[model samples]
Target chain A: MAGKQQQRLPREVRERQMIDAAVRVFSQVGYHTASVEEIAGAAGISKPMVYIYLGSKERLFTACIHREADRVVETVRAAVHPDEPPELGLWSGLRVFFRFVADNRDSWTVLYQHARTQGEPFAKEVRAARNRVIAEITAMVVAGTRMPGGERIVSERDAEILARIAIGAADSLSDWLLEHPDESPDSLVDRVTDLALVGVERYNTGDLPPS
Target chain B: MAGKQQQRLPREVRERQMIDAAVRVFSQVGYHTASVEEIAGAAGISKPMVYIYLGSKERLFTACIHREADRVVETVRAAVHPDEPPELGLWSGLRVFFRFVADNRDSWTVLYQHARTQGEPFAKEVRAARNRVIAEITAMVVAGTRMPGGERIVSERDAEILARIAIGAADSLSDWLLEHPDESPDSLVDRVTDLALVGVERYNTGDLPPS
Candidate 1:
């Protein structure tokens, strides 16, 4: 197995392998301590090959964030059917999100922990990735409430806040997923969806209960 | 001021000065790059004085987290009126939280960024502090809903989720505070409280309307 070099593999397959290995190492030891050499070694490729494929440790880290971020955003996009009830669609999207986090611990770690830990370039990459997901959520939120007979729950800006709230729930629940490894993603998804959607409805109805 | 050496100061005053300086240095550079010597220099004290006052770098970092966490918790505890309705209490708590973050950006940076970036001991310290706040929120949530005639919207476990949602909102809003430095904490507080409490109410009433 050692004699068959990973470099001999197709570029796409080889790059994926490097990213897979990179995520593991970065998550385990964290950003500052992880090295390109270690990532390449874990990928079973030469350091120069890693450099050629990914350029630098920084770029490799950014690529991992980009890939995982795309995976999460795309997962939600594919899961939500435009025609479904907004709550059901929201449930689906959130379930997809938790499942993605549950199944992809290494990926989640890269997107949340490592990416933001690095300075400006990488942190901005994470922010952009997150903003994309927030954008998707925001658009859905605007659609769900702005329709005829629908409750105008939140303002344009408030919709943006709800989008962040959803992201925050997903982010916090992702941590829960890590700790409660035996928990089902569907259950957690229901928990988060109920909390988030209910709040939006209350806000729309102006149900700010008096203390 | 130069004539009065920090070493000549009383223990209480000197310790506070050192922790204040540590927050600045740790926030400026990442934790791994921050040093006791640099912190001491920032504090206008000797290196040995820092060690004598705070024990070790690890202990010093832990102390910073502890101090900042105490400040936040105490701020909320002091600001909240025990007799106020649950929704109002939560609003007060969140408002104090955003105000704390805004006023003490350096301290917030230390708690949110630096402390977590360090390894297990430091991370555990941060976790404990956060858990304290979550515990406070959870207890309030349980009390608010468990009352007679109040909508028993959520289970004990669901109450736990509500606590986290509040935290998630505060966490994201803190980032927003960093970008929009001029924004008033009162306005942000109102925005967050409405979203959070309204959601809690909806949850209590089982207001899961058809999406």
Candidate 2:
């Protein structure tokens, strides 16, 4: 902005603003081109404060990755009930996943787009968050495959692959959602859940092709 | 090593070198930090030659995307026969997709990773590549769902969603393959096709859960 107007804000609030600005800049120009000065300017603070508050660019990016990943993991983790039907659990998890992406496009970009591709510092952090979510989904999937008396149909390994496919579908759909803003999470929840679970069930039953 | 060594090569050979250098640099440092000079240096040529041969970094990146995208599409398209059973077509296509990524890791990174994340100059090009392949797979999916007399079990739209799921699975698995280098493409082709096609079959054959 014009001449980096010094807004006298509390340290906590200022840090939030800096992080928010960094998300926008990093999402827009990506990690390499996004400068601390530009982020500070966008936050209406000085460059030194960005360094003081968030440390180096590497640290700033790491901060963004951690923050966004935590929010996504928290949002998704809080939504599903392990006790419910597994497909239902997947439906809830996917509903939250898409809702989270729709609401936080910048964070989505930061987490899914920019951060994953930024090499080691961001890669390790992003992968940890991803593996955690995938594991949770895998558990829900395993739960879902149980019959009325709790007889397991799909194997754990098969369930894990199905869970990853569902996650990948949601991830790709989330990217598609960015392009088509009006699409709602509820609409997608049914389509994706139906498409994925139907296939999983068929696989669990007699759907495997002649071997 | 000391000075810029001029490789007086043919236009075709020089362009190939430049694109190879680009794939390495862009994958290493990412699009924003990957400079034209760095690409030229990696190619063992000077800056102006890179410009003359590839036009601009933007064009060079576009070239890389097209080249890699073309290679992937050609490989997969050549592998799967449309007249074959749809699931088998999918199996063959995925086998080639994973094998291509395994053999050409840098090209895989450039096409799948860097090309997608870099904004609009590359977005349209990358999206075109993705949509083209998705469309091809969608057709194979539609073909796979045909009945004995050619009546279809899965509708066109349903097949498209399933195709996207399969593509998403392959994309995610390709990323997984990066971490597990020893894993064979054949092993994954079996698993992914089983998970995806079985679900589609159940969905088509009235395998819906009791309401």
Candidate 3:
């Protein structure tokens, strides 16, 4: 016990611990319902130490949002290859997104549910994160329209609309999946990709080969 | 003056006055933010009379939600045909949806923003109203698919997914449009319809159609 106690954690390790705690707390109680003392308790640290590590509650909440938002964005980005056809790229990106959410329900809840209801600044952070996700989806749609040999290219406005629909489907499905945890990400992603591709297909030639 | 002061209002006249007053108060201060007193004052009635007419705050809120939800659902339902192909039905439905929101911004906001965030029983009411919209959209998707088109036929699961996506996109766009009041519903609906049709066309055909 004494030896274990002496093995101090690294700075990065401690910072991650605090953020993980913050995410869990925020997810459960929401922003207004959560308190600094509760977060400190959840982190297995003293209130003063938590204050020293993360500063104010607002900063701590933002830190959690940033970290989770970055993870979500990075996962989606890494899953897709820009060089690939838009349909396949979008398929991969969606698979990564569902998998990430399935693995991190707490973080998703914290980011989607708790943050949006916090009002003002917190709402803005949530919107920014949401905008990033939508933007990534939009890029994939744009790429699909610009594929070589593709005809009847989608207009920018139309592409944006498609992007919004795709994002909405993904989001609403994610919320539904949370309630029905048994559904596989592969199945969900497969259906969504099929549906999304259908939406953009009319804008391109119906018989065009995949790029 | 004596005749007007002594006259008793008809039931329909009083009910209309209460609803009009309620919409104004609820829209301005939100359901939770708006007080019964304010609503009564806006209606030019005493607090006791207001309570006698509408019961408690919860009852009043439910009344408001019921009226607005019915109006929205009825408007969209009238625009969509269960027999028509899904794409055309969805396009018509979307136009009606945007029109309803555009025409009754405050009522829509009351149902969507204020009630949705309050959680629990109220959210369920909103969800049911939302499901009606989704159900109509789902029916359209189902109608679009053919029996011989068995493999590509719209599954109930997929139809639900499509409905969710369509509804979410329309709802989010409406929310965004509320802030940018200069945007006309006709132009926005046209773009959204095009985008939705693109997806539907893609679903109908495996890939992009040849030009």
Per-prediction TM-score: 0.75, 0.69, 0.77
lDDT for model 1: 0.76
lDDT string for model 3 (B88-189, tens) is 666777777888888988778876676766655666777788888778677778767656646655688788888887787777777766766887788887
First chain of candidate 3, TM-score: 0.75
Score candidate 3 by DockQ: 0.25
Q: Write the per-residue lDDT of candidate 1 for residues B1-211, one digit (tens) a residue.
A: 7546654667779899998998888878857788999999999999998988888888888888888888888998787776555556777887888888889886687667656554467767877887898888778767765647766756677778778777776777677776677787887766665655645554556653423
> Which portion of correct inter-chain contacts appears in model 2?
0.24
lDDT (C-alpha) at residue A194 in model 3: 68
Model 3, range A1-211, lDDT digits (tens) per residue? 7666655455568888888998999888877788989998998888898898889899889889889989989999988888765656666776788898899887788776666655546667877887888787777778777746765467765566566665666777787678777787888876766665554553355422221
**Per-model TM-score of chain B:** 0.76, 0.76, 0.77
- What is the per-residue lDDT of model 2 for residues B1-211, given as tens digits with 9 covering 90 to 100? 3233344446668888888888888878877788999999999999998888888988988988887888889999999887776666777887889999999886677666766654566767877887898899778878776778988767776676667767877787787777777677777666766655554544456653412
Q: Model 1 off-target regions past 4 Å?
A: A1-10, A21-47, A56-59, A82-89, A109-111, A114-124, A143-153, A193-211, B1-9, B24-47, B55-59, B81-85, B117-124, B147-153, B193-211
Docking class of 1: acceptable
Can you write out model 1's per-residue Cα lDDT over A111-167, one digit (the tens) per residue?
576565545677788789888987887778677656577766656666677777778
Candidate 2 — which residues are off by over 4 angstroms?
A1-51, A56-62, A85-87, A106-111, A114-125, A139-160, A194-211, B1-52, B55-62, B109-111, B114-125, B142-160, B193-211
* Model 2: pairs clashing at backbone N, Cα or C within 3 Å: A199-B199, B86-B144
